[model samples]
Target: MPTQQSEPLPLGDTIQRYGLVSRILHWSMAALLLWQFLGMGLKLTLGRTPLVSFFTGSHQMVGTVLFVLILARVIWTIANRRHRPAHGDGLLGLAARAGHMALYLVMLIVPAAAILRAYGSERVFAPFGFQIFPAQQPEIGWMVGIGDALHGELGWLMLALIAGHVVMVGLHQAMWRDGTLQRMAGRPRG
Candidate 1:
């Protein structure tokens, strides 16, 4: 018999739901990104203190790790492209696809720009205390300029996109009752 709408999805990517890898990547990135924002938000609001210092200190390292995770996610996504659940039909689906594409683009660019800036900076940046790039004698103007201009601005924009993503998930769960959340959380539909 054909699977019912209420059936729990498979362990791997299926027409009805995401696989374990996808769900793991999705939620892990969500948590790490939340930490990044939370730390920054506290720094901005509460000003510098020992607690804030702790968070800000880890920010660069965590951001670097996030960049690596994003790369892994992209690779996994490409490998699973054909087997993954469909976004659905019509305008909502198109919007979902566009939103996801935007998320990916921003995710890739945010840390990349920062890393570029780090590479070109006059002061050495050693994330996790491992010197990835030695300090330059003179800062590269264009690299620093790109990072200075886009890093914070695009970071905020990415945050907005993340907010929209959460709202959309809530909509799927509440308004549509589509079991969309189950694709990433819970046990699946039934």
Candidate 2:
């Protein structure tokens, strides 16, 4: 007897666009990154207000969560790399790839530095009330120094990269007329 064949299951990435998992990770991280920046921006502008407290209160915990999500996203990207949409050809493609790499590098570094500092610091880091790392004696001055030196600077650099990413997306839509945003957005503009 002949057996019936079934259609292949859809994947989480495609040459034309991103899939559910990729879109979710992209938007979720975008929101979290925005939250981090918003809190910092408010802190600088508004000083010690209740609103700032509300946002800044969860900053460390959220950054930790973002770090984990980013790691997962990177793994997912690697797994889907072959099936993913092309960055395109020539200098524009090279720029796109470089920009994305820079973004990913800074994203990983900023939080990793902070977590490293927390691990080596005198204060216990109980993100969401669960102690991940117990307090250390005398603190690891070097670790804290690394965090102090890199975290904020790399964070601002990440912000600049993010802004460039956004502007490039806008340019893709406005000038190039490429459906670049649709890769993560899931739908082309009407």
Candidate 3:
């Protein structure tokens, strides 16, 4: 019987056009998203604590970061559309693309609506005295009500999107042994 000398996987050769900055931003955004969801959970259920406050404040900061980051992501995606994964004529792939587009829409809508709601609340959004949010007086405006309502509703929608995203990623990692999850990992496994 001969012992096998296995060849190493060609992972480096499988690299995406996504650069270091893009990869870093992608992972950081994913992690921060978990933290932000935890913060929202605390706000909804656990009530305020030092930890909750920390997470909420951090979530807001991260959300602000995300608002800008998503714009960058959009520009990058548009500029480098050719580098994207092969979304062939497969139905599953088409569905995946549709899911991606929905997620992107939610990404833009949720944070922006939250930001606007915060502005409507008339809270002093002075991120270093720079009026980080629009300064409108906190009145019982219908627009505020609608904004807040959709903002809250979008939370649940976002949860669904995130859950689906995770499930799909896990499915690819577990069943297909694909790089979906591995690429997002800090140090991709061999």
Candidate 4:
């Protein structure tokens, strides 16, 4: 009789759970988003103190990085859509799906609005000492207006959604006793 050999773990997602790439993207974005929120929260609470400045000093660069990561995550998600875990059935599942979609929407929009604001500003949009968007000659009022209107408002909205998401996950763990978090945080299923 031949001996059985185990298969190698996949880097992409599988039906049972998220794989290395998906987990990396998910956790990375989570951590970065937390940083952004913390910085902004401190700014709001503490005014322009050095402590707030310390966190916010890299805000633009971090936001730019987050935008790129969001794009990559979206592409990766689409590619892995068939293989990843399902949201499950019935009302809760539908709500989960809708909530996730909204989260993605706001994630894309928040940085996008800021980028638009940066593009329309008289100041050059440079992060990490490199220029990305050049300053508008007369400053595009419409672009600036849209960005100004949406960026902060939608950001706070995103934060609220994130809090809700975490609460739901906690419910899953405590009440449902489901391994929902394991989909992203646990080791890949064999």
Best by lDDT: 4
Find the 10 residues in a row with the least total lDDT in model 1.
Answer: 3-12
Candidate 3 structure, TM-score to reference:
0.79
Candidate 4, lDDT over the whole model = 0.91
TM-score for each of the candidates: 0.92, 0.92, 0.79, 0.93
Question: What TM-score quantifies how close candidate 1 is to the native fold?
Answer: 0.92
Q: List candidate 2 segments past 4 Å from native.
A: 1-11, 188-190
lDDT of 4 at 126: 97
Expressed as tens digits, the lDDT of each residue in 22-107 for candidate 1 is: 88788889988999998889999999999988888788988998999999899888888898878888999999999999999999
Give the top-scoring candidate (TM-score). 4
Query: Tens-digit lDDT track for model 3 on 84-121?
Result: 54444688789889998998899889888877777776
TM-score, model 2 to reference: 0.92
Clashes of each: 0, 0, 0, 0
* Candidate 4, residue 132: lDDT: 92
Task: List candidate 3 stretches off by more than 4 Å.
Answer: 1-17, 138-140, 183-190
lDDT of 4 by residue, 82-167 (tens): 99889889999999999999999999999999999999999999998989989899999999999999999999999999999999
Instruction: Give the C-alpha miss distance for residue 52 in model 2, angstroms.
Output: 0.5
For model 2, residues 1-190, the per-residue Cα lDDT tens digits are 9986633335588787788788888999999999999999999999999999999999998998999999999999999999888999999999999999999999999999999889889999998898999999989999999988999999999999999999999999899988998777845333
* Candidate 4 TM-score, C-alpha based: 0.93
Q: Order the numbered candidates by lDDT, best leading.
A: 4, 2, 1, 3
| Candidate 2 Cα RMSD after full superposition onto the native fold (Å) | 5.3
